[model samples]
Target: MALNARLEIRQGQGLVVTPQLQQAIKLLQLSNVELEAFVEAELERNPLLQRDDPEPAETAEAPEAPAASSDELEFSDTSTAKADEAMDAEGDDRFADDPCAGGPPLTDWSRAGSGKATDLDDDAYDRALRRELTLSEHLTLQASQAGFTAAEAGIAQVLIDGLDEGGYLRLDFDETAERLGCSPELIETVLLKCQGFEPCGVFARSVGECLAIQLKDRNRLDPAMQALIDNLELLARRDLSALKRVCGVDDEDLRDMIAELKALTPRPGAAFGGEPAQTVIPDVHVRADPLGGWRVELNSDTLPRLLVDRRYHAQVQAGSRSDADKVFVADCLSQAAWLVKSLDQRAKTILKVASEIVRQQDAFLAFGVEFLRPLNLKTVADAIGMHESTVSRVTSNKYISTPRGVFELKFFFTAAIASADGGAAHSAEAVRHRIKQMVEGEGRDGDVLSDDRIVELLKEAGIDIARRTVAKYREALRIPSSVERKRMLKAG
Candidate 1:
């Protein structure tokens, strides 16, 4: 019974994630941008690793790049079978060719990730082709030509510096006056001059001020219109009667004023250059197959074409300069080979997971959002013969372009809401979409759907969701409560 030590032999299976295994695991979860950075770092660290980019002549000879699309998996079944067969062999066996290598499939597609739809907007193409002058640059140039007295010009520079990205002068005149060692009256005078520079509403201190400036430019800043701008909050609340009373205008005139107000820019500086919007490089592209089903493939432009330089390895090996040098060379060879294999494996795993998701959500792709089936990571994991955790990693930060639009892989794996009739469960996303449709299509006569009422509608549609669940979904959608909505829809 007492603790005792004895020589014994025992064996048990355990997961020991080696450095190589860790690399594969890390590669699975990284988004395209992160993966590229990781590959670039590895290239720098390992001399034997090289980028197998396409030659310029080969690229030029290639046909014009197709629109953002899904290939029918040029990585053939036979090639995959061959890869699987050789995977267990030594890493040295497959250094000759990169299994993931191909044409720059995304060529023009990566730079323009908004997809082919952007092509329809010639303005978008034009904007992309030209480097724009920023709000700061445009204002500074105008100030130089704006022709002000020395003191007024100095005050204008201070005012311009205080302007926000919306081109609104957010500076407190008194605080700015103190900072610039000038009188607040002089600051106001300079600001008035700066306001007339360009874009019409440049030096506005408030939304009402911004709009009033624009109206002044168009010779429409009548007293009633000015009153309407001042009471924009009432207009936003849809209190048409209140707006008409406050502005001293009839219903017809108020409606016209509101329409004119809508046409003015709320954010005048947003049109000018700011920090560029980041474009998502999708990991997978799903497109309609000519014959029938959905075609899914990896966005190969995102996949780094990597190869192990066996020639370099052989050259390094033949020298046999020292034991340390031999070890370093051998280690580099191992690392380079493992990286190539890991990348190939990562690509295959992504395609497998994506294809299974497309299969499960086939109804959604063919029809619309309402047809999206209840899905979870476990469902995809089991179908693809992988673990739930593995599927989660594959979906992390990964995006897919479908016929509908570019959606994150995680978007397809919505929680399930039980069915009222005990039929197939409904996807939470689909239910949320349904709730949104109901709210948006509500009659202008002022009938707003309450949470309880929404619950009833969902149940009628075969969703067994509770009133609390309905409220939660509504809140998540940012739809106001029935009381709030009724007030919003109040006419008088």
Candidate 2:
């Protein structure tokens, strides 16, 4: 075969994801909180992008006598005159250059504070004032204070990053040494130092071990307690007698020791002195009335109204020097416009999806959990004319605030079980709730209903559930067996 390079022409159609297209798609899928972050990022990157400043106080003037009609008012005071001026000002340069002229701004309604504009310098100042010490930052501070060699500091950094989110040193000593190009002894030495750093018990290997290190720091690790921790599985399984025998303690002493053990925080790494609580700002607020039914409202107060400044955009287009700068500005402006459009579409889609969910699950709103019907991704997808995956993406990690309580979007969708009255399928969650109610209302003196009895009760109510299925549901709900319940009642 002759070796040669040749070009051949062929026609094919395919989709390619350019940066602008990708941004639009991403913006569409973003929940209100995520959209806020994206807009913040764009504001940092593009000088033309800004949170819509409150309409410049409209220059208060004395009001004239009311016009006979809007048509009789001064042309300058009307919106039509302003539109004509905008059209004449841009001329050919309007749509050819600026895409943000007629679009709404990107906004988010999932943040908890009043949406206000702060300058770039203010952002910097805020960051400087409230800097957080990440796991790496804390380690670096410790290493600097300890006065380690440059090589040792580098090795320490690698180990610090290797620590898991829970701040445990999960890497084996040898593996860490190989990656750091140091001996295992050096790695262990650095790990020991890391364990003593701020927050007290970081760089530990396991939860039990983490607690042990903190306890050792405070001189509180008793031999029996340490033994119990080493065999945590036995303790967790309620093998109380076995634990007592192993620790050689009396029942009262064992109980007291167990209580003390419970007080210890196994994940000591989480004790980062003063982290603020995460406040959840709901995207949608829904209320149900006694007779009037449900009403859905978007929390507009949390939304960030962002827009491309038309005034500044014209200045950039008219005063450009380099081709690169022009292209950059155009690209950024396009992105800003697309972001605005995507945001509008996103809001509409979220509202539509929420409305459909409320309509389908109105029974849950009126009555309680027992009235909840079985709903799934396919049903929602079919109703909304969207793919099941799209529905899944919309529901995942997003929450809906409703009359009952704050619930994840997926909470509305449950597997179906045969109903008690044999009318239709009921939600598994609803069935589980009914099982819980029956268990809760059981006679105290008489034998508490076993799984079989519960199944019979469900059958009488018109729900056709098997005994094993009832047992599984009961177990899932954390309800104890009949024997355990009887013992619990006696103890009560």
Candidate 3:
């Protein structure tokens, strides 16, 4: 081996994912809500970036640049303009006039009282002023109402704090009493007092105790009812005969008792507290065109419009003297430009992928699930001249609203199932739907369709699938075996 180092010039081409490219890829995968959050963060960090406000056509004007000296650099707004023009050329008018064109109409309650204030308006105003009371607040108010000595009130508060969301006390009475330097009898007494609060079952230790409290309040806590409450597992299994024997009641009386039990709230505290429900916002909208084709558009309401302020950037850069300040301004300008370009590219890519999906699955939209052809990411990616991974990322967490309903972009891509007659393959989703329909249409008195029988039926319909595959698809659809189905039917 030679000791001296030798220099050689090697020239080749390779793909490199720069920081901006990485950001574009990330933005492509994020849902609309997540992209809004990311853009808001960028707007805060980059001084040259600002949100593009919705302006009327008459009020819109071109942004002007500040006057600069001959020595100062003048930045042009051509890049931003070109990006906007590209987006407009792609499909700006796709959702211009109608915000809710493809989807259902949304009610604007803010403008509901513009005409006149009626009784419903007063009720709405009152509801807007009211706040939902949490479980802890309700319990604290009840504890305050129940008169107790200072020490007893402290113990009662501790017991209330120990209750779980289901209104069951999760703490051991003896351990709590030991920690508080009090006797277990005192703890038990405080617990009993707290159990007398509203909602009927505030401080019970078990499900049986919870039901017992409600039953006692209703004046129905007989020995038979108590026994029935104690054996909840038997009730869940629908073991009617065992419940009847345990409760020592005839069929008619047992039915009445079971109905009463069913009417009682099992989770008494659930109504008071939980996380609020979140609404799903679709990312794309698909509608029928006048020429009998499909029209696809991005949900612009969910997408944030952003622009780079080149005038402000030029002003800042011209005044900076230090190298560090100049570098910071340059970095901000670069980031803002990249972000705007990335957003435009992301929107175009999503629209392209969604349009192709509508084209390929038009049969499904016009007909039904049975006509959904076999599809994959590769097919869509090839049609759109992109990589399969890119298509996958674009489909992740993205939804499209159609005449059929709102569905995820990935919902149309299913594995292929071979056809019995060596024709075109069938979609796995279609096969699963067929299996589900067959199971649902079975009569209670008729013999349940076993996995083998399902395979036979599918083969007769020109679908070549194995018995195990049929069983797998059935299980995925949450359909039980023939024996379990029969047992459930007999029990019913």
Query: Across residues 1-492, which tens digit of lDDT does each residue of candidate 3 receive?
Result: 769888999997443223343345567777786777677767777787777766523322222321221112222211122323443555542111111122222222233322121111133224423757667668877765454433455566567656777777888877766555568887787788888888897688888898899999999999999999999999999998999999999999889998999888877887785333335588888778777777777787877777777778778999999886776677666556656655765666677778788999898678644456678998997786655666788898798887755667876775788999998898776677688778888764467899999999999999999999988877765688999998977787
Per-residue lDDT of model 1, residues 1-492, tens digit only = 799889999997432223334345556777787778677777777787877756532221122222232343322221233332344343432221223323222122223322332122233334534867778668877765554433454456557656777888866777655544557787786787788878888889889999999999999999999889888889889999998998999989987998999999987877887544347678888888899998887787888777777776788799979776776676666556666666776777788778889999898677654455678987886676565556777898798887755667876765688999999997666677688789988765558888888889889999999988888777766688988888877754
Q: Which stretches of candidate 1 lie over 4 Å from their true place?
A: 1-13, 53-276, 429-461, 466-492
* Candidate 3 lDDT: 0.68
Where model 3 places Cα greater than 4 Å from the true spot, the runs are 1-14, 54-276, 368-371, 432-461, 466-492
Q: Per model, how many backbone clashes are there?
A: 0, 8, 0
**Residue 3 CA error for candidate 1 (Å)?**
11
Compared with the true structure, all predictions reach lDDT values of 0.69, 0.61, 0.68
Ranking by lDDT: 1, 3, 2
Residue pairs in steric clash, candidate 1?
A: none
TM-score, prediction 3: 0.51
Model 3 residue 95 lDDT? 16
Runs in model 2 deviating more than 4 A are 1-6, 21-31, 56-276, 288-291, 418-423, 432-492
Where does candidate 2 have its weakest 10-residue lDDT segment? 92-101
Query: Cα RMSD (Å) per model?
Result: 19.1, 19.7, 21.5
Whole-model lDDT for model 2 versus the true structure? 0.61
TM-scores, one per candidate? 0.51, 0.49, 0.51
Worst 10 residues of 3 by lDDT: 93-102
